[model samples]
Target: MESTGIQRLFYILWAIIKLNLYILVFTLAGGIVLGMGPAFQSANDVLLTSGMDYQNITFGKMAERFKANFKRSNGIFWIFAALLGIVAYNLFLASQIKGLLWFILSFVLFFAILLLLVVYLYAVQYETTYDISIGNLLKLAFISVFLNFGTFLKVLFGVISILVVTWFFKGLLLFATFSLFLVWSGYATKNIRQLVEGKLG
Candidate 1:
């Protein structure tokens, strides 16, 4: 029998609120790192570069290290997501659907791409002149990944896609990215539950 809209809404709400604390633990940890790492690096550069040591510290070298670190920092996020996927796969024995896998895979790819682009952004900053070519590509790649993750990004895209859409918008675009996090969590929960039951039961 087809479920009523009320029932569906209830399910979604249940999923969203059910032990949100646990989900946020992982998400927030990842999000915080994603949000703060760059600022941290910038501060690091400022602090260490003080007292007339700026000449020794080259922008080109600094950019590469920063880009690589950002890529790896966000790599940590993807690693978390991948772990979630493995857990889900273990729980659910149902035939895999292309639809759901698409979502899962897309998220991974997008996250990784964003990380790479961020790395590239820092990496390119060390160039001799103020050339925008490298920075532009990094910006484009960053926005593409952010947009792939959620509905909020869509709304965000609609607003800024025109002006900043040329290469991309600056700053972290994760403002409302957590809106559908519950859905991702729910899907992960459901599949993992299925996989666990299949093995144990």
Candidate 2:
């Protein structure tokens, strides 16, 4: 039930990479959706004109729309994030770590990435403000969490290399930076898990 430092690092790296890939995908999809998707097009115009649309539609209508939009093909961003958390689960389990802690680590890791992505995207794309429901966000996060690991690892690895050399690469820097964060996040997460399980020497 002990994990070595090197093992911890690998899982950490994998976690971060997958997390960033979710960001990249989400950024592009969001660009198309909230950014320019036909469905969300009027959303911005309405906001700009009225200053708020919260009262225009019933909360139920808003929830329904959120569910429909989040399940669209372009909504794989959160799915990727959720997958990253599962990676954390595997890393701990493989190292013989156990208990509710694994699930908590995975959830926190997934949540942090999801929160960071939402904040970054809102700041980057929205004018002054926008309305998004939390229920859909959670749904997106779960989709990402539930993806297959082999695919997730490949994505995670790609992000790590990019992040490590982003400044030099220029055009790929966003991808690189995103990758770095995921890897770092994974490392931080694994270390925490190790400490909790008393695996740290």
Candidate 3:
């Protein structure tokens, strides 16, 4: 019998726990060594590997991609750092100028950064699945978002739904939250690729 989407998602979670223990450990270590940027990218690495339908993946292979993931994460870190810097500067200006202009600018930039974050979430999946360069990945992310705006919403919705689920099961957050997130990301990333490739209607 064929499995349902929930079953498949659970299987993806199990695969991560079972097959990618080293990656999980490294994820924790990366978070400590370099901050959550590398850790987030490490999770993306697992999401990409999970896209492979949980087959023929080895720790050595995932480890080989570490440098690339770290590089990608480093770029992401700087982008976020810049975003934070802008927000901080604008807020300081707002306090001094006593005007809405700086506050508005900061607000707009916050949403802009947030949008790019969601875009990059999808883009990293593409990068892992296709080994696309960062320059091309940015292009691909925008194209995917423009062409499949509805699909993009669906991906974000899935993530939010998962967060709600985890919120209800707060006790599991420590042990299972990351794994559950990977499962959805893995599944959603695959679908996003299909949408981008015109394979899904």
Candidate 4:
């Protein structure tokens, strides 16, 4: 029996609260240096692993996976950080030039690319679950987003929902909002694994 949308949402929430919290602990602890890259990868791994029908995950296993994820995708994290720095500098320059339109467009483009990069990271994690190479995984991330646009949007919505919820209940950070978002987004992408894998393979 297929789950209703509400049921799936609750399932996603519980998965984060349960299976993915260990990784969140690491993320919150090392967030400044790690930049949520490990957390996102670990949460994606948890959801993808579960989606693939694996069972009986433990906190220790999640932590090990978190380390592996950080190793595999840290480069992407650095690239994201660099791009953010560049965009910030450009925005500052635009402000100095009094180019209001340029500033607005740059800001919009930053977010647009950031959102796409978020989806790409999700795809990267899914690929990493099967031991796909970092190079190939990067290629698949780009393709998967367009190939599975609807699923991408679902994941995006799940992410935005987490932000909204977190804004209202700031205490949710204690409960690990970023972890929840990753797991929720991962759950949203579960159905598309085969679709992506087929094309990737």
Top candidate by lDDT: 4
lDDT of 3: 0.61
- Ranking of candidates on TM-score, top first: 4, 3, 2, 1
Error of 4 at 136 (Å): 2.3
lDDT of each: 0.38, 0.40, 0.61, 0.64
- Listed in order, each prediction's TM-score against the native is 0.23, 0.25, 0.63, 0.71
In model 1, the runs with Cα more than 4 Å from the true position are: 1-3, 27-140, 143-153, 157-177, 181-201
List candidate 3 stretches off by more than 4 Å.
1-13, 16-24, 31-35, 42-58, 84-114, 168-173, 189-192, 198-201
**Tens-digit lDDT track for model 3 on 7-79?**
8877656665544354456566667455345555655665555553556445655566565677676676566
Clashes by residue pair, model 4:
none
Distance from true location, Cα of 81 in model 1, Å: 19
TM for candidate 2 is: 0.25
Clash totals in order = 6, 14, 0, 0
Flag regions of model 2 displaced more than 4 Å: 1-3, 32-165, 170-175, 179-201
On the 0 to 100 scale, the lDDT of residue 134 in model 1 is 43
Cα shift from native, residue 61, model 3 (Å): 4.0
lDDT per residue, candidate 1, 1-201, as tens digits?
357877776654443332232223333444665633332333233223431233343445444435544653354344444655654554343234357876676566555444553333232222211233544534433443343345323433443343354236422133221313222322223333344336445
Q: What CA RMSD would you report for each candidate? A: 20.7, 19.7, 5.1, 4.4
